[model samples]
Target: MTHRWLHLRLAAPLVAFGDVAIDHVGPTRDFPAASALTGLLANALGLRREETSAHQALQDRLVFGAMVIRPGRLLTDIQNAKLEKKDCGWTTWGQPDVRTGDTYDSPHRRRRDYLADHDCRVVLRLHDLPEGPDLDRLAEVLDRPARPLFIGRKGCLPSAQLFAGWLEGENALEALKAIGLPGRAFWPAEEGGGTVRDISDMRNWRTGLHGGHRRVSEGEIA
Candidate 1:
């Protein structure tokens, strides 16, 4: 079935799109992942975490694409954190308070990777579903999200608007050029340049079994 694609822009001073870190370093992908984009859509629609049906239905027929307007700078920061046991009445984490809970002196060295001044044009190709939360509904939500939207992390918000409009043509590259943004057309690749290492699995966003992207090519939208 032919799908109608939506053109949106994900521009933020800083944005991080990656999975939980298995190592000591938390790295961000070059571009946003499909799951992350879907998460943005879900948030715009105000879908709950337990609403797997809504999430899955949207994932079933979706294609994600991106054009690099500003690749941004690769920056990693060293974060010193403590192993704590719950919060202290929203005061802060690891704050000593017998009324709340005892905190541990577990100092953890975490390396957080981020992209400064990152910007990109995201294309969301969604199928026409019947039950609920259709692409048309998503388009409306993007115009005026039920809740305020952010990029990937809460701290990182979009510096510019999110929605561009409906895609004009079928060609992905053409659609991107129509926006008139100046940037390179890069895609997922296994080797060399223009590759995106994504942790979000398009097949299953939760399990991530089919996750771990090798690379992204310009025309190939997975």
Candidate 2:
């Protein structure tokens, strides 16, 4: 049987600018209800901010739900229910019946193939920016030359560095950051190591995987 999971939804799109956007769909904590999984997935795929073609297939799901796919698999022809507040049930990209998998490896290849066909890539600009329990704490932790950036929902796009900027009134760095890290996953560490691993081996020196690194800055923080 196919394993299933649900995530919660939080926050909404606040702004959109040029190519990048911002959204407040992060979870309140680590609850298990619904999540911004689809949003992240759609965003990652570099789907044009105005594209709604795939929204119906994965809306109102949790960020965690998007990670349910096995590594190196594609998820295509996947369809969703026509209603909200539901599981957003899914099917294969091309086939009718649920694309069944035999072993865990089966699902991985399937998902990888589906994503390849649809050209999926997650966007994570806001997540790349700094975020902590509080802005103050976040500010302290994010005082590096590397400007703060994150993934945005819809309306929340970075323009003048007004809200999600290092300085309150700067745009140069904002624009530069936008070009550098257009996607969002750059912010949150993958579950295990790459993208969907359950637990990352902090001591995986061999793989060069460990604790997170601060986005370095050009000059000293002013």
Candidate 3:
């Protein structure tokens, strides 16, 4: 079956593909996570953080594959900040995230990893559902999102447009190769053909937690 796919170019000065984080150390994967891609699409559709059900539904419907057009260098950022109980920080939802604890004499610190000068291409299609947003809707919303769209993180903004047109293929892997942009690629295992690896990238938005592992094929798609 020939499936229609939406093409997205994720070229950014700094791109952070989320990984399983422990404590104050936040790591990034080489390619985008399924959860992160879902969040990006939800944001483009103007879904709020509080809209857990909507986010969950959208995530469940997403099907995609990604290719690293440029293997950018990994950049690590060490951050430290001291804050008072009354201090508040801005959020993407247009609300202030206030610090609830007492004033801290010491600085709160964390390490974050980002991909610097990276370029990636994604081919996405939605599962056949009775109702919900489709590929055309996603492309439209991404072009003129209700809110500003960011790649992975808010500070890691895209250097180019997210929508790169469309492609048709038998599966996500086939669609990716049709682009003719060679690099390491990752796709759902069921799509067939690659080194199978178990990855925990899905998220339970309702509980705000990382969920079970899913199999993916990782290999070069030249």
User: What lDDT does the true structure give each of the candidates?
Assistant: 0.69, 0.25, 0.91
Please give the lDDT score at residue 61 for candidate 2.
Answer: 20
Q: After best superposition, candidate 2 residue 28: deviation in angstroms?
A: 3.3
Write the residue-wise lDDT of candidate 3 on 1-222 in tens digits. Answer: 999999999989999998999999999988888899989999999998999998888889988999999988999999999888898988777899987789988999999999999999999999989777988999999999988888888899899999999999999999999999789999999978899999998999999998678999999976
Off by over 4 Å in 2: 2-27, 31-35, 60-222
> What is the lDDT ranking, best to worst?
3, 1, 2
Which stretches of model 1 miss by more than 4 angstroms? 1-4, 83-102, 186-215, 219-222
Candidate 1 lDDT, 56-145, residue by residue in tens: 677665666677777889878898867467643433456555344556677778888888898888766665566767667788998899
Clash count list over all predictions: 7, 63, 0
Better of 2 and 3 by TM-score: 3
Per-residue lDDT tens digits of candidate 2, residues 126-212? 212232122333233333313233223232232322223322212222322333323222222322223322322112222322322
Question: Model 3 Cα displacement at 56 (Å)?
Answer: 0.9
* Deviating ranges (above 4 Å) for candidate 3: 86-100
Taking all chains together, the TM-score of candidate 3 against the true structure is 0.94
**TM-score leader:** 3
Worst 10 residues of 1 by lDDT: 186-195
Rank by TM-score, highest first.
3, 1, 2
